[model samples]
Target: MKRNRNFSLLLFVVFLGILFITFSVISVEARKYRVKKSKPHKHQNDRNGNGNRNSPGPAPAPLPHYPTRSTIFDVMSFGAKGDGVSDDSKAIIAAWKAACKVSGATIEIPSNFQFFLKPITLQGPCMPNLVLQIDGTLLAPPNVGSWPKSSLFQWINFKWVQNFTIKGTGIVDGQGYSWWKYSSIYFLQKNSKHIPDMKPTALRFYSSYDVTVRDIKITNSPQCHLKFDSSRGIKVDNITISSPESSPNTDGIHLQNTQDVEIHNSNFGCGDDCVSIQTGCSNVHIHHINCGPGHGISIGGLGKDKTVACVSNIIVEDISIQNSLTGVRIKTWQGGIGSVKNVSFLNVQVSDVKIPIMIDQFYCDKKFCKNQTGAVGIRGVKYDRIIGTYSVQPIHLVCSNEIPCTDVDLIDIQLKPSPGYRGFHQALCWNTYGKSQAPLLPSSIDYCLGKNGDPVKRIEKSHEHVC
Candidate 1:
């Protein structure tokens, strides 16, 4: 009996030890998870609350203060000669730097004059409240060789600036037609014989906040018209960007690795997308704009190789497209692993568009893209109240053959096919809405195709279904 009791006691001690070990392990993991989850929010909140860095138990850095100015002409005491061949970039930079040192001042460029500016960077590290008001035309240097080269971005950068406003009724001409011509020639030559080198973008903005670019006409960009990376609280309004439709890679506005951005009341006519958002962007709102003669708004060609990119919480509404290639599109590269979720498109009006609505997951360009592991697909995209009058197919949703699309809702979409087209043309719907026909107006559902040409599905028309 004594021996048995001793054995039982030993077993009990072992059980206790195992339980303690498991409990300790679980506790440590839980604490670690809590810390991990709370750290980002804590840091974000601290930055928002304190307006700067977040050091534990210490006072945060004071917010950078900039003086406010009523007019840009108050700080301009110098001017560059209007000779077309003279380099004005250095003079402009010097004047801007001096004005930035003075609080709340405007650096003005007067009217009735033309000046040639070389590729120059207008940086704002210690200055926040400087306004660059141009009432005159700022022309680009004639020679493309005068532009500098950098590996960080194709264009020169305006970095880490805050409260900066570039507003005026002036023109900033990139004089980019020559550059575009050269690039085309280079590409054509390379295609015939060898691989050619890539060129740089026109304008690149990095790590800037509270930036407002308004009321300007920008023309003839060499590469992308405007690009923003890792910027927050950026508002682009009342601007017009125009390049020749044949201009290659002249995207109007491209956003990558950014957050909290809004683009409104703008017009874009370019070769590539009117606005393309790629990789690591969130909380993006694009509204009240006109896009045409270009590729439409896009999401990705994301996650090539081991690189991972995600886009979330994007809204595109109140947009008008005229004679564009595709109006609203979401494209993802094959063999990429990322989720694009909570995207909403509402009140979009299309006229004379090719593919008005498209979600292409098998986006492989440049000599028949091949993926060994199959295509990666998109998740959780919703479209409501999209009306398209198309010369071609009204809506085209092509998912990957392997991983098809899921959670797609299209409501109150009215497509009026162009004359000489077949009656109620092919609306390619696959792996979407799960064997349910879209809610359409009563008069148009008799010949509609749903889920591999089955006819049991009927359109839904509730009074609340009117878009």
Candidate 2:
């Protein structure tokens, strides 16, 4: 009887175990089913935002659809004139206007031909979501004065527009060599009276959102290669800009009064700063860029008159500079009231550069650069992982009198120059107060001796002294 009772007990225990296992498996399967059932609904909600299953077919297709009419050749032929003297700007403008009216149309520039687009402004305070597609060369007028001012600035304002794109495999040649010549001549003559008509930019977008300019070759711009002024949400990718390094004021990209701007995967060889960020600009992220034979990225020469300027929260990373004048710089005038703060540089590589990093607060221009108070001040700057191989010292720091720089940090900065060049170093510092406590050199004695041949111990923590 005891054996029979033990057998019954064992069978009951096994049965209970089996029931628990089955229940656990069913619970897991049910949870998985719930998750699977919710996934599509979640995606649908993301797309529709209101959880409506029937939300207007794929957001009504972006404004410019492919395979549309070729507006440049088919619509505005203008007798295939390759020179800007043909007066095709009116026809081109008309074609652009017509194509823009029709949603999802491509204004194509046919290949194997050059279209000399005289200075013509393509102004658009128009509807959102437009695309300007180019496949042929849009040549600029060889004569600088012949290019109209209206076409350059007033054309294609694009203010308050969204989802605008400019994509092309073709070139927009500014023919800026002549313009540069004129500017030089005008400056040499000191002929302020002539006011040689201002040449329009190659591409200018203002107050626009979600804009993309990609895969285009822009060269020899009379003024700025690209200007983003008072605009937001811009992306410039895979674009190439080139000009003579001596080309006067030919900045690759100039941003002023803007926010949330990103420039990546681009190459710039220009006359001025590859990228210049001026007043009222913030949240700028620039990465994967190759800049050379020009000024690296810069913020200001700021605080002219009472015009307040502030640039903050900028990041420049993964950039390669070759033979540039300065790698990364923040320059402010000697007597202006404004502040530049919260700028960071990371993982930047440099070769053959004059100064890999610089902060010049004593920025004095010709004629009126008197030692003035409140020129501008820099604060909260962080430089990390900056490596370079060059002839000159890799770093320079200068601060102005009266208002000193504050909160500057240099972390993990490894700079080694080529043989027989000045070692990795720092230059003149006046009224500069900050901490560079992290020694980058391999030797502690060398670190104690500042690059300017002064003992680092005397100046390590002082605020008002010049080095």
Pick the lDDT winner.
2
Model 1, 1-467: lDDT tens per residue? 99999999999999999999999999999999987765545345453464234544446679999986433442235557756566666678777777767666687877776768766677776455778877777786544566554431444457777888878888777777767777767756876432225555666788888888888877777777788888988889999988888888778988998999999999988887899988889999999999988888888776676356678899999999877888889887766665676788888988877778888776776777776443444555767777867777777777655556655666777777655655336676554433223555323332332343222111111111111
Compared with the true structure, model 2 gives a TM-score of 0.74
Which stretches of model 2 miss by more than 4 angstroms?
Answer: 1-85, 148-160, 192-199, 418-427, 437-439, 442-467
Number of clashes in model 1?
2
Instruction: List TM-scores for all candidates, in order.
Output: 0.74, 0.74
Question: How much is 115 displaced in model 1, in angstroms?
Answer: 2.5
In order, candidate lDDTs are 0.71, 0.72
> Each candidate's root-mean-square deviation in Å?
26.7, 20.8
Query: Candidate 1, residue 70: CA error in Å?
Result: 11
lDDT of 1 at 450: 34
